[model samples]
Each structure stands twice: as C-alpha cells, then as structure tokens.
Target: MTLSRAESAADHDRTVVVGAGLAGLAAALKLAEAGKAVTLLESRRQLGGRASSFLDPSTQELVDNCQHVSMGCCTNLADFCDRVGISDQIEIHRILYFLDEQGHVSRMSAAPLPAPLHLAPSFLFLRFLRLGQKIQVARGMIALLARSADTPGESFLAWLRAKGQQDDTIERFWGLVLTSALNESIDRIDLHYARQVFVEGFLARGRAFRVEIPRTPLSEFYGPVLEASLRSRGVDLRTQTNVARVVFENARVAGVSLRTGETISAKNVILAVAPHHVASLIPEENRRQDDRFEGIERLESSPITSVHLWYDRPVMTYPHLVVVGRQVQWLFRRPAGNEGYVQAVISASRDLSARGAEEVLSIVRAETEELLPLARSATLKHHRVVTERRATFSVLPGVDRDRPSSDSSTAGLVLAGDYVQTGWPATMEGAVRGGYIAAGSVLGLSPAQSLVPSLQAEPTVRLLAWLAEYIFPTRKGTLG
Candidate 1:
C-alpha cells in the first residue's frame, strides 16, 4: 500500500478565504492547520480592516482608529492572539471604574464572590443609580440569572418593562450596559442579545472581570502577526487583490474571477467579508436558496466615532474610564510615554456623526475638560476624528434573525464576519468566533465539540475559586 509522492500531494485540499480581518485570518489559520492549502485575499494594503491603526504623520507615533477591550470570556480572540505570538501585548485590568462629567467616580473591583453578589456592592455604590434603582437592578440581575429559558428576540426595553424595571433605571444603568455591549440603543436591541451580554460578561463568575486591552495599535498587533503567521504556514496572502465575482456552476462554486481578469479554482471558498459586500460577490442563483447569504440584506448597521487628542501634558491618570450621561461612552489614555495622547470612543454614535469634525471635537473636548478638570490647564497639541459609518450591524429587535449562519447552501462556500450569526453581537469576539465556526464547517469538523474542551475547563476552575471566597469572607486584618 505504498503511495507515491504525486498521490500524496494530490490529496491536499485548497481553500480560498476572502478578506483578511480577524474572521478571515482565523479561518485561514484553521484551514492551514488542517493540511489545506489556504489563500487569503485582502483588498486593503494592510489587514485588521476596521481595527487597523496608522502612524501619526506629525508625531510619528502609532495610533489606533479606536480603542478595543475584551473580557475573560473572549477566549477565542485571546487564543488567536496567542497563536499569532502577541498575546502578551495585551494588558488585563481586574478592576474597572466609571467617571461622570461631574467628577463622580465608582469602581468595580474583581474581588472574588458568588456570581451576582460580587457585583452588588459596585452596583449599590454606583452614583448614576439611586438607592431604589440599585435594588431594582439587583432584582433584575437575579431574575435574568434565574431564568431557565431564552428571552424572545424582541426589544430589550420591552423585556425590562415586563421584568418590572422602571424607565428611570433603564436610562441610568441598563441602557449604558446595553449600549456599550451591543453597540445599539436599548430601545432597539434584542433582549436575547442583551441577556447574552450580561450573562457572559457579568454572571459567568471570573469571566466577567478579566478585561484585556490592547497595548499597541490594532493594525500593528493583528496585521503583521497574522500576515507572518499565515505566510509561515504556506498561505498565499494576496494584499490589494480584489475578487470581482464568485463564479458558480450547478449550485457549487467553480472558482473566483479577479478584478485583473484572473481566475483560481478552489475546493472551498469562504466569503469572510462584511455583509454589504456579500451580494455583489455572490451570484444571483446561488444567493436565492442561501438564506444565510441573503439575510445580510436585512441587517442594518450602526456607527462608532472616535476623537483622538495629543496633549502637552497628561490629562488623566487612569488608563480607561466609563462615562455615564455623556456623549462619550469610554475613554482611553494611550501609551505615549512622556507625551500625552488620549482617545475617546463614542459607541452607538448617531447624532455625533451628523456634526462636523470641529463641532464633534469641540463637544468631546468640552466633555473631557468637564470630567477631567486638569485638562483645562493643559495645552492642546493636536486632535483627529475617525468615524466608522457602518462599524457594526445594528443589534436591534428582529435583527438577530437576519444574522447569517456560518454554513451556506453552496457546497464550496462558507461565510464569516462579525455580522454573521455567532450568537453574539458584532464584536471582535463575534468575529473571531465566526472565523472558528467557518473554518470548522469547511474542514468538516464539529465546531461546538471542538470548542467545548477549552470552554469548559477555565470556567469550572474560576467558579470554584469564587465559591471558596464567598463561603469564607476575608477579614481586614488577615495576613498571608
């Protein structure tokens, strides 16, 4: 039963992955690992897509388009970073704080305790919520965690009303959490999606508090790391390569035609690009039966805006702050050494985008100064505005059904993107998960079973540790 070299080489499968974002890179890596010849095509000169960063021409310093943060449950993304050899570049914060425009501050420490109990003190002390509101919020959390069945994929606002939560509480606390987690307003977000956010980020024991933030620009973090990793694994990464149309024959993908009039056949082709671009690349006939592919048309998008400022002096001491009752949702103090650079992330920014750059910058500056009074005395160095008009699919009511599945009807074609249905919102985690799922589907592997091993172990360990701390509360004078 001796096989010849030609016979052995002929057994290898070839896969083409379009787009070089997190989802695309993840699929490409998995395929390569499975002994498939993979080629990744990216229209942009650099990778990371929306998460990319650039060097400021004036200061010659690296700056990301916006700041991104991840929690402990972001195992898939962390694993991808580890595989790419840059996991250490991310810093994890066990404790997070919120600062309002009036200089009021509330801190949430990752102190070990029972599931929701660990967060109770922080919730009670939150200046944004009144005493009665805190109790209502606690009851809401209890109800959410105790529920056995999934909520209907309807408006989160309606769900809150059904839970007996008042509108004032939703406006103060629930709305902020929903907006930050889903990147959509509470009135529009699906209840199930909102529940998933709370369950995964807060209720899942230690999973809630392990906040990981990028130390370098995302483009530098992901672009080079992924490019080098893929190339080393023998993947043909074609930058500036545009796929004109996906050619299909007899309900199967025949090949892809390039913009320059070239063609390459593949055993499988994964369409890992954004939702809006899917219709143009796929054929009309193939898209007809493929509900997942066609579902992209039903999904709407939300916008995210960022205001970057370089100051003559450091304006804030903290690395990040969550602001309530303000246009700015989150703020980050970038690593500029002696120089001062700050970035403000405006999530679910609708009205902010309608204003001109000067107006937007002015509002952000005024808010920043109001929150950080010391910034008023500091000299303004430079400012820049970055807006992602379609940053993510709107996670509004009934929109969840529109999210595309990883599997498509076309035999040789799969889909991957944050907007694709990964049982999560349009986030880095969602994007990475979609890539993993798409890769598994193309390679004929059970994604759920493959993911189970990693998912189960850590959560169990964290849960036990949390339980131990709860049963035996530490005394103030106790020493090691």
Candidate 2:
C-alpha cells in the first residue's frame, strides 16, 4: 500500500536521507543548501560506511581500509571536497608510473596538447608494449572513440581482440587498466562503462593528468567535513539509527520507521542505501518480490583486499604504483612521522579473500620486496588485512542492462549508489556521480545543472583541430 496524502505532507518540504556514505552525505549537503529541511540517518555510529577508517592502537595513527585514487575527470568528487571544505586535504599528481611484472617501469604523463592529445606521448612510451604493439593500441583506442556512445558496445576484451591486440598485450597493459579502473577483468566489463573510464581518464587532456588521493583517512577526509558542513547548514544528522521500514499509506512514501518505534515524517525520502538493502526497506507489496533487486541483478560484485604493513624503514619512493604480473595490484606508501606504512590493494581479487590475514600479509611482503628492494630487508613491525567481499559491482558483460535509474518508481523516494547506472564503474567517480544525480532529484532540479561543474570535453572533432601539432609525434619529440 502507498502512503496517504496526510502522511506525505506530514513533514512537507523536509527530506530524509538514509545511509551516510558519500551518496547520502552528498544528497544531504545539496538538499540542505537548497533550503530544504534535511535529516540524514546512518546505521553506524561513524559515517563514510565502507570508506570509513580506523585508528591503529599501536601507532596511534589513522588508517583507511583501502587506498582510493581519483583522476581529473572526477569533477563530482572534487566538488564534494570543495563543498566539505577539505579540498586541500587531497593531493593530486600529474604523472602515473606503472611497474610491470618484469620490473619495467613506464611513466604516463600529460603532454602540452589540448585534452585528449596530451596523452599521446605517455601511450607511445609505455614499456609494456613493443613498437608494433603501440601502434595497435593507438588504433584500438581510435576505434573505441569512433563507436557510438549511446548504444551499448561489445565487451572491452572482444573489442581489443577485434582490433588485433595480442594476448600478451592485453595481459601486460589493457588488463592493468581495466582491473584497476573497473575492479574487474576486461573480458567481464561492460563496454559502455569501460569506454567512459577511457574517455574521462585518458582521452581528456588535462583531465587524465590530475590523479588525487586523500592525504587523511576517509572519515577525516569526508565524514567530519561533511557533517560539520551539513550541520552548519542546519541539516539533522542521526547516527546509530536504523530505519525499520518505510511507511507507505497509498502509493507514496509517508515516513520512515525508526528502530525506536518512532516514526519521522518526511515528504521526500531518498533511499541512498546500497542495492542489496533496498529490498529490505521497501514494503513487500510495493516490491517486485523478486529474489534480486530489479534493474540491478545483472551486476555482480568482485572482492578487493588491502594488506597494511608497518615497517621500521621506508620501503617505497613513490606514494603509489600499479603492479603488473603479480598478486599485488597496487601499492601505496603512507608514511607517518618516522614509521613507514604501506597498503597493498588486490583488485579483482577472489582467492586472496579466502586466505588468512597472515597468508595475505606474507604474499604482500614478497610482492613488495620484488617491487621495492628496500622492503626486502626491512623489519616488519605490524600487519593488518582488510577485505571487502563486495568491494564493487563487477562490470561484466551485459551489466549495463541491469543498471537502475537515479529516480525511483515511488514518488519522493530515490536510489543512490555507485552501482546505480552511472555509466561509470563502482569507483569513487560512480558514487559521487550517483550522489550528485540523486541530490538533483531531491531538489527537483535538472541533473545537468547540479552544483558539480561539467567536465565533458569539447567534441572530439573540435579538440582534434586545436591539437593537431601535438597529436602527431615526431622522432624529435622531447620526452621531458
């Protein structure tokens, strides 16, 4: 049954946001800024949900479960940082260095060219490919650019294969990009999302250049920053509270039932929770009664594991690097004072999750020694393992069909999550995009005009003309 008119207007003009993750906090901030009475509820005492951080008792320092990085195209997330006043707490890099299984290092940096052309040099110098392989990779990228953006295309792996990419090329280069960007293999990722990642990450000139990571823990980076900002704007943030169920009187949502049996009435309710939690909150009658959530069942999830090791000596020269041909996909060096801390992220991980913490740590140590020789002789002070079984929705074949719209069927009830059909993978970009879209829905505004500035580069044709000289590299092209 849906909610009655009386209940709908019980708290007219007020909006309640469930889930205190990025999506929920983003919606609350947006709605509150629009002069709407907003209340945010989080089940956990602390915010940031999966992005939350914990303090290490031994070191008395803060640490995040995983190391997350964002690129220049992630305008929504950057805007979020701006909104929360923590933009300065994030550091951005212009160059990305890759370390292959063979211990060969290649640096991908931006060129002087406009948007997409700026990436040509980095592509040419990539050590993972041979001279012929580099040409094939460029040709494949051009073909991808030529494809229609609106229609769903072939699997990324198939498209590469059709472009004559060898198995070795895919394993050495394409696999690393796909696995890190989508948290799934190339063969399994949806073409639409993969294309988006490439377009925003590589094709855009200055966009692909700026890679940002939080200098602090997720909570400090977002939780308190958002909470203070929202509260200052008069948003009500309820923590450690569970919404028993949403009350529907007629065909609309009336209010939410709290664990205390108290009902908080609100005209608009944004179900900013994950997809798996939606079925539990919505009324049984209103639900489709399917085993899996509709419009999202096609998406499956893969796991990611992060192993943290504290050492007496610094083990890495750079803050982060992508590892190829190893169990360790990415390694981040987080140094606090004299203590050296490192986090190794295993993306598209399955078997690693089943292993014990000690086993995971040992593998991470071995892998670290291979990449950074300094780490081999360092004394291990401490180790911790964090695993997110459903770290992100698998970007498998036909996954686009299962993506859900930001707007919900029920009035005043919207869905928000990285998995909610954002045309991006379940990365920070997707989560922030979903939040921005959902916030627009809550404020009855067009998503295109949200607070986040658009990062869409000019049409490829126009950009190409302006960047012709830089696009075609000569033998004399300077690496520096």
Candidate 3:
C-alpha cells in the first residue's frame, strides 16, 4: 500500500522531535510558538528527563531525581519557566547558608557594596575559611580575573594551581562551589566551564548566586502543567512513545521508527536523546563517517545521589544548606511538607555510587542528625535514596572539542541536549540553551536570535570586568 505523492509530501512537512526532556520540550515549545508543526515523542509518560521526578507507590509521594537548583545566572531557564508559566512556582533565595565540618554555620548574602565587592562583607565574615585562606582565595580570583579565556580542553585543577590557589582554598572554597556547579570534581572539570561558573555566577552580580528552588515536586510542574501548556500551543505531545531508530532516505533524515513498528516521516528531526542513546538509534553508516557522532563514545558521565528522608518533626530552618567536609554535599528542606521531608544531594558521587541504599542512608542519617541541631530532636521516619549513575555528562578537560554542534552534518537533523555545545555546564540552563540553539538552527535563524539576553551586569562588576578586560582586552565574555 504505497501512499500517494501528496500524502507523502504532507508527511514530509511535519517536524518530529525525539525525547521530551528539558532540551526536547524547550525546542518543541519554541517551534510551536513560531507556528511550526511539531511532534514530540518521549519514552516515559513523564517529562523533565534527568531532572525529573517520580511517584513512590508505597508512600504515594512524588520525588525528584535530585534537588535541581537554578541560580539567578540561569537566564535561559528563567525564560523557559516564564514561557511555561512555572516561574512563580520557583522561589528565589537571596541568602545561602552553609555549615563547616565542625558544624559551624555561615551565611552568604550580598552586602551593601556594589558589584565585585558586594559579597565582600559576607565573604570576609565567613567563620569557616581562615583569614589567610580568604586572602589566598581573593588572590586567586584576581589571577582568574586577570587571565584571558581558557580552552575547554585545559584542566581546571591545573589552572587553579597555576593561579596560585592553595589546597585549603581548593578544599574549603573552590571545591564546594565547583563540585556543586560542575557536577564533577575540580580535577575532572574543564577550566573554561569552571571559570565561567565563577565569572558569571559569582562575580557578575550580587543576585547571580541566588538559588531558585521549586515550591512543589518537579513532577507536579513539568508533568501535567507543562504538557497541557505545550498542547495549548498546538504541539503534538506524544507520551510513552519510544523511538527505536532514525530512518534515513536518500542520505538524509527521512523520519524515525517507533518500537511499535510505526514510522513517522518528517522534514526536520531533532535528536534530543542522551549521547549514549544516539549512537544506537543512528544508522550504522552515519556512525562510521561522522566523527562528531563517534565522539559521543568518548564523553563520560557523572552520577548524583539524592537521599529523601521523612522526619517526625521539622529538622532544618533554612530552605537549603551547603555542607562542607561531608559525603552529603547539599541538604534542601522541603517547606515542612508532609511530615518534614528533606532532600540531600551528593554531586559527582564516585565514592558513594557503589554503596547500597540502606548503607548510604544509615551513614547519611547519622551524619545529618549530628550536623543539624534540630535533627537531633526529630525522629527519623522513612528514607528513600535515589541515585542517577549518568545524571549528567561530565564536562571534562579536552572534551569540548568533541561536543557536537546543534546542526549536525547529517541533513534534516539537529541535536539538543545538555551535552550539546551550549557553552555552559549540564544544568537546566544549559539544556534550555541547547534547545534554543537547536530550534534556531532548525528555523535557519542566527545563534543569538533565540537566546534570552543574560541578566545585566552591575556597575561594580562592570569595573572589575573592565580591569579584567584591560588585562586581556580580547576577553569580553560576560553573562548571558
């Protein structure tokens, strides 16, 4: 039963997008908003991908993959949230609380000072880092500030050492920030992304470091709410539809084949799935010649462990706390919801990934009770540990050259994921950026056309940026 020429032409007019994760959804929404016919296919009924949430059958409670926080610097994520009308569901915190190994508390808030010195008052008063360590950190920042751009292939640790950063600064200060932001250790992260985290997230503006947390579970927002919103925009959102392989005709992407043996042809296709998944789905011939697609094999992944605990009573006063010298890197208080639920995040969890759930919970529970004063009084109820082995693609040294562009060599195909060359770490911001880039490529628009403008740089930070620019006049990479 051959389809008529008109029918085949109609099928070719459609645009099919694989993987309804953040990157895919963002691309779909943008295309739909632009009046393009779009179809999004997802393997799971739910959305959000790596930053997704799931329901526990026993307790019937919803849980997120981990605590996904958006810093004020994440402009694209904020823009996407605005588009989806979920921006209000996120709470932006101006102050960040941290506890040292000895359980000493410190608060990080912007001071009255402007720009580069805005956090000076708060940072100077931090009780954890010694005075000398602070001086050394400041000096390192100066070195980082004076330096020009760094190659994504260069090692972050090597750069830090060359900048005269001490072990204490790396441990107490740099380590804490890098591990959380990069989702990889300082030694494993690339210098370009690490410095971007500092230059954009920290030194750009006072509020750049402000943390944004969702008021409710991620499933509650990205699930029905987002699906309905996308549907309203005329997107053909298909859930529980797994794409088995990409169909090629005449050396171009003809469409995609589903596991159900159904094939949907399209004029344009965006492969938004993970890097590892792409090679399997792509045609063998395409894999053989395209070095970009072949390089997906070389990219490594890092894991994140999230421990959700139900306590008898409220355990923490702060919404979230950054922990130093502990296996649990970050603890987020979930608004005392449903019997005081708490989430602990361990980024780049190499050492702990091999441990069993019960064992990890036992060790983390004991440590949590000891660290927070309020936790000592609250009795532990139930705990569930969620571990994502390939939570994010590690932005390792010398890996940037291997990252594929949004527009691949394969005709009628584009790519979108946190792994794409989004010029950022594998955060929600990067995913959104990837989608925007892919959408732009599909629409034949400029790279900057679809991107949201970055938050404005303050006057104080502008001066420091000016000084840094003076050192390396060609280095004018600012926020956004």
Which candidate number would show the highest lDDT if scored against the true structure?
3
**Runs of candidate 3 exceeding 4 Å displacement:** 1-10, 147-149, 469-480
Question: Candidates ranked by lDDT, best first?
Answer: 3, 1, 2
Lowest summed lDDT across 10 adjacent residues in model 1 is found at 1-10
As for TM-score, the candidate ahead, 2 or 3, is 3
Count clashes in each candidate, considering only residues at least 3 apart in sequence or on different chains: 0, 8, 1
lDDT by residue (1-480, candidate 3, tens digit) is 121235445466778899988999999999999988889999998888887788887678888878789899999999899998888888888998988888888999988777668888889989889999998888666556544644567777876776567887898899898998889987898878887888778777878889899888888768777888999999999999999888877678778889998878788899999887989888888767566785778889999989998888888887888998888889988853664778888999988889999988988888888888888888887889988999889989877887888886888888998898888888889999999889888898866887897777777666775586555343323220
Error of 2 at 357 (Å): 2.4
Which tens-of-lDDT digit does each residue in 1-480 have in candidate 2? 233345444257788888888888888888888888888999988887778788888878777878878888887878887878988988877778888768788888887776566788787888767898777777656545543432354477766675578888788777878887788876787667776777667775566547788877887887676778889999899999998887766767677888888777777788878766777898777666332357665568898898888888888887788787788888887634544778889888788889898888888888888888778889889888899898888877677678787776777677787877566778776787787788888777766766466476656633553443344321221110
Poorest 10 consecutive residues by lDDT, candidate 3: 471-480
lDDT of 1 by residue, 126-158 (tens): 787779998888766655543331454667787
What's the TM-score of every candidate structure? 0.90, 0.90, 0.95
Model 2 alpha-carbon drift over 4 Å, by segment: 1-10, 289-292, 335-339, 451-453, 458-480
In candidate 1, list every pair of residues with a backbone clash. none
> Which candidate has the top score in TM-score?
3
Q: Output the TM-score of candidate 1.
A: 0.90
Q: Give the per-residue Cα lDDT of candidate 1 at 379.
A: 85
Clashing pairs in 2: 2-248, 2-249, 2-250, 2-251, 3-249, 3-250, 115-205, 188-396
